[model samples]
Target: MGILSDFFVATPEEALRYANRIEEPDEGDEIEELLDPVQYKRFTDLEITTLWAILEGSDWDVDRHALEYIEIGEDNEAWLNRFPDELTTLLARLEPESQAAVLEAWAGTEELACDPAELQPVVDDLQRLASEAAASEKSVYLWGCL
Candidate 1:
């Protein structure tokens, strides 16, 4: 089976709680479910890494080549706390043309196998979540499971 990736908007406390719980899954723990909360289309690690690069304006294949996935609160506590703001800032700073270019590149790339039209909505949803999280003073937690 492949990996499924998703994020959620929650208070910093809630984000950390979910992160801590999900990092070490337990028999009674439903934390992973809480972190994701809802079902979503699974994206491969390659596709997710490409998305990360596009958002950060780095090389799509190289920047996150070493990353397995964006774990929530593990050793990345600082990032977990700040991602909402960082994503919002990055999203706001990217020029529209640049955004389109990134999407187009990912769509045409054979490795990612992303369809531009189909992928656009997912991108938009991420932006919306980031924006809402920032506006509400909540943190956005990124999580993935295989």
Candidate 2:
């Protein structure tokens, strides 16, 4: 089994509940975890690389620094919050082709065992979450467990 990541648009209050694993019967809140880690990695790598490419358009290589800005979970588990500003900024700079290229690169590489087609929905879901977070002035978080 590989890692699993949960991506969500959580309000400040909602974030607290998920982080603490606090359960409220009436709240009916459901956190959406991606289907699998292999698929999730596509979103993770592509999002980071695309952001970097937009910021540093010259000679950007995904393999050279894919994990540079990406934070890893220290204890088989970790959470990273992309604040509204961060989400908005990156969202503004991303291009459609850049995202497609990232997906293509992942498919072509031997490093990951994933079908390129499977990653598209994950990408769409992430964008939806990011959009919701930005509109609501909330944060987007990637929670992972191995």
Candidate 3:
């Protein structure tokens, strides 16, 4: 499933567009470069959702740490909090193949938002999806919300 197979091509554009394309290395690009536990606390449902989609199941996770996004809260416990309720169950109803796809997608999302606690659920979800995909006669690849 080459979902992002074509997503990384650097295209040439007009002078204006090209100028906008010029990217100097920003601090954000290197997630590890930032101070640990964050210097400021900032998060929103939409932002978390977006980060989840981009980071999980990619090379980013192999090299990065999930704790980078976590800010040590007053409780001193770190888990991914504040995600929308709808997202928690979004993968529940899908077929295993779809679930597998969703899990893959979710992992990509998890690359950034994934916490140590959340990893178990993700593994469970993927296992369910794999079993479903295997039992049926087809291998399915789900992407995004059904």
Candidate 4:
């Protein structure tokens, strides 16, 4: 199986504290308890490079703004990364139509073609998460497992 990813909003300290905890198989209950009302979305197989491209409308440059690795599993099968504030701001600022357009473009690029219609919920969740993160002065963190 490919990577299963969850995008969530949390402060740096909170994210690091719960980074490894999220990999547990408790269906995120522990995380919810720890973060209390955590805002997140399960978006599998969505790579940071893809998000960078979609948000910046250009090739991803690691030097410019990369996903900052906060923690890594001992076996190297999982990790937590923090999203750059700029990308979060960019996503938070996208209009509804622009979000839909991004989803349509993403569908076109995926190996297994997805219906943009089906991705509306994902778009909405991410938009809401980004906005909430921005408003609260927190960052978006990705928890990925393989």
**Best candidate, lDDT-wise?**
4
- Tell me model 2's lDDT, rounded to 2 decimals: 0.50
* Tens digit per residue, CA lDDT, model 2, 3-80: 555666665555545544423433333432321211254244345445444434444565643432334324335444
Order the numbered candidates by TM-score, best leading: 4, 1, 2, 3
Which candidate would rank higher by lDDT, 1 or 3? 1
Winner on TM-score between 2 and 3 is 2
User: CA shift at 131, candidate 3, in angstroms?
Assistant: 17
Which portions of model 1 show Cα errors greater than 4 Å?
19-39, 44-49, 60-84, 92-99, 109-111
Local error of candidate 1 at residue 97 (angstroms): 5.7
Worst 10 residues of 2 by lDDT: 30-39
Looking at candidate 2, what is the lDDT of residue 130? 60
- For model 3, the stretches where C-alpha displacement exceeds 4 angstroms are 1-83, 106-146
Q: Model 3 — which ten-residue stretch has the worst lDDT?
A: 2-11
Give the 10-residue window scoring lowest on summed lDDT in candidate 4.
37-46
Winner on lDDT between 2 and 4 is 4
Candidate 4 per-residue lDDT, tens place, 27-118, comes to 45666575653333334334455765776788655567567777555857767777778778887888876777788776666542678786
Query: Which regions in candidate 4 have their CA more than 4 angstroms from the true location?
Result: 22-30, 34-46, 62-65
User: TM-score winner among the candidates?
Assistant: 4
Ranking by lDDT: 4, 1, 2, 3
Q: Is candidate 3 or candidate 4 better by TM-score?
A: 4
Candidate 3 structure quality by residue, lDDT tens digits, 30-81: 4223211121122323333543443343332322322122232343222222
